[model samples]
Target: MICYFSGTGNSMWVAQTVSERFRDNRLTDMADAVVSSNNLNFSLTEDERLGFVFPVHSWGIPWIVRKFINRMTIDNYSNQLIYCILTCGDDSGLTNKMLLKLFRRKGWQCRHIYSVQMPNTYVVFPGFDADPAELEQKKTAEAVPTLEKIMAAIVSDSPIDCYLQKGQQFLKSRIIYPLFCRFAMSSKPFRTTDKCIGCGVCVKNCPTHNIRLENGRPVWANNCTQCLSCLHRCPQTAIEYGKESIGKGRYYYGKRKDSQQ
Candidate 1:
C-alpha cells in the first residue's frame, strides 16, 4: 500500500509513478483515508511493502501528515518494510532523518528514505518567480529519468540509507527553523476578489480544505497548510495572499489546457 499526502500534486505524481511499477497496489490520499477521529483503514497484507509519499515543509513533515502518522493503527504486520519518499523544492537535508526517527518511535522498521526534487512552489520566498508553463515542462523532462532510476532501485531492493546527520548540527547552531516558522505563520492572510467565479476548484485542491465559500467569496479557514494550492489554481486570479501574490504567475500540476467557465 502506498499512502500519500499531496498539496499541489507534486507528491501525487511521484506516488502514481512509483505505484505503476507494482502489482496489487493501493494508492490513497491521506485526507480521504482518515475520516473519524478513532477509525482509519489501510488495506495492506502482512507481506506487502508500505510506502509513504509527501512533501517536506518547514524542514519537517507537514503538520497534517504528522498527525495522520501518529494516529494510524496497524498491527500484525511484522514483515512490513516501510519506505518513504519526500518531494522537495530544494535540498531535503535532515527532513528524512527526522521522519525516520518519528517512524522508529511508532515501531515501524523503515527500510528506505528517498528524496527527490520537484519544482519549487513556495512562491513567497524572495525572487521566487518562475514561468509556470516552462517550469512544468522542465519538471516533466527531469522527473521521467529520475523516476525511472527510482523504479529500478525499488525493483532491486537496493540499500539507500544515508541519513541527514548535518541537519541536527545546523538546527542547533543556526536556529533557522524557528525563525522560518515565525515568519511563515505571521504572513498576512489571503483574500478573494469580486472576480471569483466560485467554481470550487481551489477548495477541492486545498490539501487541508482550508478554504470555504462565504457569501460566494472564498474564505480561508484557520487550519491552513499554506501549500498555496488555492492561490495558484484560481482561474480568474481572484485569490491573493497579499500584494505579493498579485500579478505573480500561477502553477498547476496538470496542464491547464481544459476550458474553464
Candidate 2:
C-alpha cells in the first residue's frame, strides 16, 4: 500500500505516479482517511508492502501526519519493509531523521526514506510565488531522473540510506520543528473575503474537516494543520490568512492547464 497526504497535489503526484508502476499496490490518502476517522489505526497484514508519502512541513512532518502515525495500530509490522517518501520544494531539513525517530517511538521499524523535490506550496504568506518558469523547468528536469531512481529502489526493495547532515538535521528537526508547532499552526487568521460565492470547495477539500461554511463564506476551526488546502483551492481565490495573503498568487499543483479552474 502506498498512502499519501497532499494539500496541493505534490505528494499526491508522487503517490499516484508510484501506484501506476505498481499496479497491484494500494494507493491510500491519509487526508481522506482522517476526514473519515480521527484515530487512524489500520489492520493491514505485515506481509504486504507499505509505503507513506507526504509533504514536509516546517522542516518536519506535517502535524496531522505525525498524529495519524502516532495513533495508528497496525496488526504486525515485522514483515513489512515500511518506507517513506517526503515531498518538498527544496531541502527536507532532516525531516527524514525526525520521522524515523517518531516511528521508532511508535515501535515501527522504517527501513528507507526518500525525498522528492516538488513544486513549493507554502504561498499563504506574503513574498512568495510559484516557482518561476525557468526554476520550475529546472526542478521538473531534475525530478524525472530522481523519481526514476526512487522507483527502482522501491521496486528492488533496496534499503537506501539518506544523506544525513547532522548539524543541519539537528537544527531543523529539533529547533525549527518545535517552533513551527508553537507558532505556525494557528488558524485564527483564516477567513474568506467578500468574493466568496457560498461554494463549499474549501470545506469539502479540507483534510482535517477544519473548515465550514457560515453565511456563505468559509470559517476555520482551531484544529487546522496549516495545510493551506482551503486557501489554494478556493476557485475565487477568496480565502485569506490575515492581511498579508490578500493579493498573493494562488497556485495549485497544475494550475496552468486546468481550464476548469
Best by lDDT: 2
Candidate 2 residue lDDT tens string, 61-89 = 89878877777777666757688888887
**Candidate 2 local accuracy as lDDT?**
0.78
Stretch of 10 with least lDDT, candidate 1: 160-169
lDDT of each: 0.70, 0.78
Off by over 4 Å in 2: 125-127, 161-167
Flag regions of model 1 displaced more than 4 Å.
Answer: 34-37, 41-43, 131-135, 161-174, 178-188, 256-261
What's the TM-score of every candidate structure? 0.85, 0.89
TM-score of candidate 1 relative to the true fold: 0.85
- The sequence of per-residue lDDT tens digits that candidate 1 reaches over residues 29-117 is 77555532456535467678888888877566766677778777676667577788887765565667677778888777776787776
lDDT computed for candidate 1: 0.70
Clashing residue pairs in candidate 1, if any? none
User: How close is each model in CA RMSD to the real structure?
Assistant: 3.4, 2.5
TM-score top scorer: 2
